[model samples]
Target chain A: MKKSIAIDMDGVIADVDQHFLNLYHSEYGVLFTKDDIAGKTEETLFPEAGAARKFAFTPGFFLTAPVMEGAVEAVKKLMETYEVYIVSAAMEFPLSLTEKHEWLRLNFPFISWRNIVFCGDKSIINTDYMIDDHLKNLDNFKGKTLMFHSFHNVNYNHHQRVNNWDEVIKLLVEEA
Target chain B: MKKSIAIDMDGVIADVDQHFLNLYHSEYGVLFTKDDIAGKTEETLFPEAGAARKFAFTPGFFLTAPVMEGAVEAVKKLMETYEVYIVSAAMEFPLSLTEKHEWLRLNFPFISWRNIVFCGDKSIINTDYMIDDHLKNLDNFKGKTLMFHSFHNVNYNHHQRVNNWDEVIKLLVEEA
Candidate 1:
């Protein structure tokens, strides 16, 4: 039987950091490099409180976010080795649900709609392995977890870390 | 710790058959009674091929679905006895994602966004019990399953069947 793996959307495959940076530049008229967020949380990326959530709730926020570098190729490769499911904690921002679905359809066209999930919590998820940026999601999953490295989650070290999709491919595919 | 229960949205709580009947009436100048779909699948509710799917894909189809009779009261009562989560397999119809979220917010206002789940498959769900109309969903659930009554699922008998919201309250709430 093929092993099932759950993959997170935002920081892992969607490159939410780049999205935040772009949105911040467009909203504030000031461009900031990745260094601005080094070892800092996502919330701090915006000067004002709740700006991260405000952007998340925006109509086109999730739809227009750039995909992570090497994500499409790496995920397609991972699909050949295991059952890949895109799991996003998206019910919090109701607007993001459809946008995320459409975004995935546009970017990861090979992934079937049957393998996509949008939920409020991740503890309900059951899979053989999970790749996510948040510890909240990884901690509850009763399976192998690969923590995708992000500025916000740099302090978290309970799970094996993958810095990028190439690292993901090396650990789950090339090394398999 | 409270035991969690996953509840299906469409045929289980949303009265989708009634919505279809109403749409068929408006679309074709003739009212469709419940007897019209007795022992028939949801796909055959409309005379034309794919009409049911067309209605489902329509923008307001999910948002306008009426809550099943007594569902609010019964579900609220159940919530007092168990942790309730609304789980809908909605990824196949991307448009339904946001609509379902809005529908739940309007009808089941007490349900937190943190407890709503929109997903493609029920097999990934881990809950103590599940109440759903489709066998495809209930069959994959690892815990206790309550089969909500629907014309399309009348013949399925693998799980405990609850004919209505009152029956659901009786079985899960009063019995508890």
Candidate 2:
């Protein structure tokens, strides 16, 4: 109960590929769609532009999206015990933090927003548990790391992989 | 089925107030716990610190946070018909979109990093549906908007709210 939980946005929250697909669609008449890219690499979605290859650290692409199912409730439940923070790497985008904060307020105003941190190295921060969608961060994260399940990310096999916050809370509670 | 889904972090991902409570306990010697604020408001969490005031938006707070319940599967299921994207907004925090992409890759690599969007205005984007916790963006979204439920934001009674994305997809699929 003394541990804290850190979560990631993007794939975990609303939809993940719609933005780029939306953009790609508007630019080119690409018909690959999400399904064509599922179980494949980013290049599958953007074949000619190599856009997926360059997206390793793109900006103005991952803020103020949607919340995953039970994301609000799970955070609510965990907040009951552990300290929660949103250490994100969303700066790679071109928007400012103020713009990002507005999205959170409009979407999840319930969060204190004070305890949030958008750092480059999330592992550098101090916390008890880490729930993210990236293997690099999760692999390096100290304490309990919960790997959020996504379609494109198929290599993660180490930590506990879950699809929702309820499972995340269950794992943390069980550990507690 | 080529469409994608997107979600928000913060209240939609995990219980934000509880995280604050954990930090509050460690910082100001405050003993306010989850039950104390469950279904309550900022007024109860921080009575002396302008409890009546609504929670402010923070940047890094939501960067690395937990995913909500059923959010993963809902996104996964929705991916069956749409390319899921994570579109979020940042305030002043220093988050890296690269790290966010890596995080998503490590967890749900199945989702292309290109799918994530750290943007400012969501209405400008196009999608079949959006599952957000806020109400303002949904005010005039061109696509179908599914409002996520939040205890802190119970005053919203004007929009079409859904308990989860499953219901949202259900409605969309039925209409289609």
Candidate 3:
């Protein structure tokens, strides 16, 4: 059987942090860099809890968000060797569902609809490898976990880290 | 809070049984109608279990399958009054995930992505009403269960039956 890879979307593939920073700048008239909010929660990044929550409910937020650097190419390359699934916890953000679907369709057209999983929980996912940015998702992953570097996860160092797509390709290749 | 309604795909929304019957005819050079397989298992529908399962794995099967009559209008109407969610046990038919998403996009574009759930289990679903073709899905539902008429579920009469979308709309409107 082909080895399967489950990849998170928001931080791992989609550049949600940049989108949030943009939102903060546009809404609050304040410029905050990714480094400024590194290893911090949304409450720390935004002025209030609701301000951060507002972004999730924003229409077209997931669709317009830029893709993470090197994600498209790296995922395509990975697909050649493994069964790749785009696993996203989209249930929390109801508005982002169709936008995320359109985003994946536009950016990673190589991935089939069969491999796209939209759910609230990650523990149900069973794959040989999981590449995600959130510690919460990787914590319960039964497979080898690869922590995709993101500003919010800067403090977490317990798992194997991949800062960029190049590093991801290298680590997976080495494992093979 | 608005009452939430969970709708099933496959036999309930998209007409999978008709699609399978068409495929069986095209593949086996034998004509089989939906009436012939009412209340029967896959083994009874096809020559073997694998033969029945093959249709699900076929590319474009979910995409090409016709939507159930009145599903689009009823679901759209339902959305106006309820927090509608399109729930499907998609994990079992991994190939149908993306195709089902696209099918909904084409047919039920009004339903937001956040309300769409693709999972292996239905027990996790929490809703005020469930419209499904399977007794198993409606059995454990915490809310009112509307059994959509399907050939296989013909014998299942425990729940309130809606033979068509008009009935579904009427029942929901009456509740409102």
Candidate 4:
């Protein structure tokens, strides 16, 4: 059987931290740096939880967000050997749906529409491997977990970590 | 808050039973009809469960299935009022993912990509209403469940049944 890999979008493939920082500056009139957010939730960066959540609800937030460096090439290379699926916890932010779809089409056109999964919980995903930034998603995953590096997840050390897509390719290639 | 509705694809919107029957004829040299599957699982229709499962694994199976009559117009009208989401138990049939996505794009272009959800279990879905053909999906749903008519669910009468999209419109419009 071909080994299937489920990859998270935000913070893993897409650069959500940069988008959040930009949103934070515009919405609150304050400059927030990645160093300040290291090992902290977005809610901690904002005055209230709603303010951070509001940014996620903004239209085009997911679409306008920049892709992670080397994500496109790495994903394409990974697709050659593994069944790659973009599994996102998108149900919570309903506004991001169409934008996320268009973003994927523009960035990773090779990925089939069938490989995109939009859902609330990641626990239902049954695959050989999962690449994600959040511990909440990785903790319950039944497959071998690869923790994609992110500022918020800097403190987590439970799973094997990959700082960039190059490292991701190295790890999976070695496994194969 | 706007009422949210989750609709099932296979039986409620897209006609998969007919497609499976056609596949059964071609694969096994046996003719099968909707009547043969009334209140019975796909396993009963085929010589073995593996044969029926093979049909789902077939490429282009989801894309080629015909849409339910009046579904396009009814869903378009419903989208004007309700926050509609297309939810499918698609994880079990990983091969159908991209085909199902393209099928939706061709049939329901108005339905945004964000509103599309493909997962295994329906119990995790949080919505105000659900229109599904399977009792397994509807029975555990937290909100009002409208059972879309399907041969496999003909014997199930626990939830409110709608024979067609016309009936679905009447029930939902009345509630609104």
Against the true structure, candidate 4 reaches a TM-score of: 0.56
Writing each residue's lDDT as its tens digit, candidate 1 over B1-176 gives 78999999998889998888888888978887877787888667667878778888888999999999999998899888798999999988888887899999999999998899898887989999999999999887889999998888877788999989998888787787
Per-residue C-alpha lDDT of model 2 across residues A1-176, encoded as one tens digit per residue? 46666666566544556566665665677755655566665666576658754443355444534456777777777778876766566544534344455555666676665555444444343467777777877887767777887656665578888866677767776666
Best by DockQ: 1
Q: Where does candidate 2 stray beyond 4 Å?
A: A21-35, A52-60, A94-96, A173-176, B1-176
Ordered from best to worst TM-score, the candidate numbers read 1, 3, 4, 2
lDDT of each: 0.88, 0.59, 0.81, 0.83
TM-score (C-alpha) between model 1 and the true structure: 0.95
Q: Per-residue error at A169 for model 3, in Å?
A: 0.8
Candidate 3 global CA lDDT score: 0.81
Give the lDDT ranking, best first: 1, 4, 3, 2
DockQ, in order, for the candidates?
Answer: 0.84, 0.02, 0.12, 0.11
Can you give the lDDT of residue A112 in candidate 3? 73
Candidate 3 to truth, TM:
0.58
Clashes of each: 0, 113, 2, 3
- Chain B TM, per prediction: 0.96, 0.69, 0.92, 0.90
Query: Cα lDDT for residue A72, model 1?
Result: 97
Place model 1 in a CAPRI quality band. Answer: high
**Which parts of model 3 have CA positions greater than 4 angstroms off?**
B1-9, B12-176
